[model samples]
Target: MKTVEQLLQAKGHKVISIAPEKSVFDAMQSMAEYNTGALLVMRDDELVGILTERDFSRKSYLLNKPVKDIQVKEIMTRHVAYVGLNDTNENCMALITELRIRHLPVIDKDKVIGILSIGDLVKDVISEHQFVIEQLERYIYDTPEI
Candidate 1:
């Protein structure tokens, strides 16, 4: 089981964040620039909430509120689901599945370290499975055939 620490190391721990007071347009632009689906809504280094594409589509666009007119705090998801650096990839996958969320902030000792997306979890699982399959094949070929 690979820990989030390893995952972050492989994926690079670059957390794209935006201030809670920032305009929705700003958050969206940051998301675009980062090529991410969500952004950590921070307030003076504290993880206040998460602003996601769903929040934008559902809250702002649907409400017909212009991005410049609204703030991230208004549309950001307040109840965030988070993970720790020591957490296993399986645990992260389970949490994301059960919570039905795309992104989770990775924390270590109350400090925000990185963020994990559903895409990241899926990629990790696929890589792990591929490695296991290759190992099994090597072992089978190295042994006598039945």
Candidate 2:
């Protein structure tokens, strides 16, 4: 039930981005440096696309060229799927499931704020379930001879 705004608050909005003109090799280096699976492709201040490990693996094969010779904009997924701060974690999960996407960029006030991965949503769901389980256990234990 948590909103993307709350989730970002908890996780911190540290989005790693790459310029569209950057080489895929550079993008890969950044991803490795940050230990991230994806990067937002930015054109100046505008978000143009998203580059992910999947894109690199799938498209690079089609190009049959070295990553150093490939541009991020050439292989990156141009049709980006994004979310908003008001969106709920559940809703984002649903969208990700339907779209078969692993990462979603969160936008607020016409600006990109953060990104959420499938791992993030799954972790939140597990945490929420744990909280509910703990609360139910507490209620049951505190109540005497129901």
Candidate 3:
């Protein structure tokens, strides 16, 4: 039941972005530098698209042209799936699973706040489950027989 805001607070709200007009090569470099599989494609504070490794592999790699010749906008996924601050981790998990996407931009009040990866949601789910299991174990041990 953790909210997106809580997850962002735990993971840090650092959203790495790239300009849509930038070359795919630049996007790849930025992705490497950030050690992330995706980057938010922004146009002056506006979320226009998302550039991911899958996009590069599927769209850019198949082209005859070089990566530098291709713009991020040309290959980025334009129809973005996003989550709001109030959204739950389970909701994000379902959305990503249904859409088969790895990243989701976090928005609040019409402004982009942070981004979530599939890995992030998975980690959060695991942590929540661990907490529940631990609580259950403590309860079972502490209970006294009637």
Candidate 4:
């Protein structure tokens, strides 16, 4: 039953963000430099929206828009789903699955604390399952004359 706070602490809470007024090209450049799939859209220290590769592909590329000229605020997803630090990983997973979203921002009193991705949740779940399986195998095979 690991908490989001614990996961954040383990993974580091730093998140890459960009201003809403920045160009889509700038967002892409920042994403490339950070090697991240998404960027938090911020305005005056407030989380405004989120820009992801999917947004670019679907909105800009498919629509034949100029990425260099378009602003991030134009294509970013403004309606975001978020979790808090005290929330359980289970809640995070549920929100991701229910919303069909890949990333979720962790908030604390209107402040962005961290970000979580589907990959991160999957990795953590797999690791925990592996540990449980190993423990079960050890108990079943290593018990002495029970």
Candidate 5:
């Protein structure tokens, strides 16, 4: 089974984060520039929360705050979910499904390594399945009078 560390290595451990004191507007701009759906909320190099499009829509509605008036610290999800480097891809998929969350931070010894999305897991699973199918086909073709 593939591990989260393998996935991070394959995908590159690049994380884009924003300060907690930043405005929601700033978070959205960073998300746009990075072409990502979420950003890790950082407070002095420590991850404090996560900001996503869902947070913007739901939190704004509940808080009745304008986008410009809102800060990421106000709207970002404070109880962030995370995964570990040693976790299996299947485990991460299950966690995302159970949590109904799109993004999960990857951490090791309290150090942030990377982030994984539902999309990332899906792509990796599909690619792995494709590779297995190809290998099986090659085995059957190469076998003689099995």
Candidate 6:
């Protein structure tokens, strides 16, 4: 039952965004530098879209479009699915699965706060399950013979 706030607190809330007018090449470079799979496309602090590696592969490589010539807005997903700080990891996972998207932008009062990746949600769920299993094992072993 971890919240997006918990995840952001565990992993500092740092959002990497690029201007919509920027070239795809620039967005790719930023993704590399951040070691992230996606980057938020912003225009004057507004969440316009999201540019991801998949977009690059599908639009740039497969289509043989030059990254330098194409803008992020050209390939980014305009209708982005988002989560809020109070949202649960389960909710995030469900949205990601339903949308078949790997990233979700976290917003607060119409302002972009953080970005959550499928990887992040998976990692959190795994860790929570592990903790619960360990607790169960300890309880079972510590119980007296009946």
How many residue pairs clash per model?
Answer: 0, 0, 0, 0, 0, 0
Error of 1 at 133 (Å): 0.8
Q: Score each candidate by Cα lDDT.
A: 0.91, 0.94, 0.94, 0.91, 0.91, 0.91
Tens-digit lDDT track for model 5 on 7-72?
999988899999988888888999899999999998876999999999987887777767777888
Over 36-81, each residue of candidate 2 has an lDDT whose tens digit, in order, gives 9999999877899999999998898798888899999999999999
Q: Which stretches of candidate 2 lie over 4 Å from their true place?
A: none
Give the 10-residue window scoring lowest on summed lDDT in candidate 5: 60-69
Q: Over 4 Å off in model 3, which ranges?
A: none
Q: Which ten residues in a row have the lowest lDDT in candidate 1?
A: 58-67
If scored against the real structure, what TM-score would every candidate get?
0.94, 0.97, 0.95, 0.94, 0.94, 0.94
- Across residues 1-146, which tens digit of lDDT does each residue of candidate 6 receive? 89999999997779999999899999989999989999999998899999999988887765566789888888888999999999999999999999899999999999998898999999999999999999999999999998
In model 5, the runs with Cα more than 4 Å from the true position are none
lDDT value for model 6? 0.91
Task: Name model 6 segments beyond 4 Å from true.
Answer: 61-64
Q: Across residues 24-82, which tens digit of lDDT does each residue of candidate 1 receive?
A: 99988888887889999988778999999998988887657778989899889998999
The candidate that wins on TM-score is: 2
Off by over 4 Å in 4: none
Per-residue alpha-carbon lDDT of model 4 for 8-107, expressed as tens digits?
A: 9888899999998999999999999999999999987799999999998888765466888899988999998999989888998999999888999999
Model 3 scores a TM of 0.95
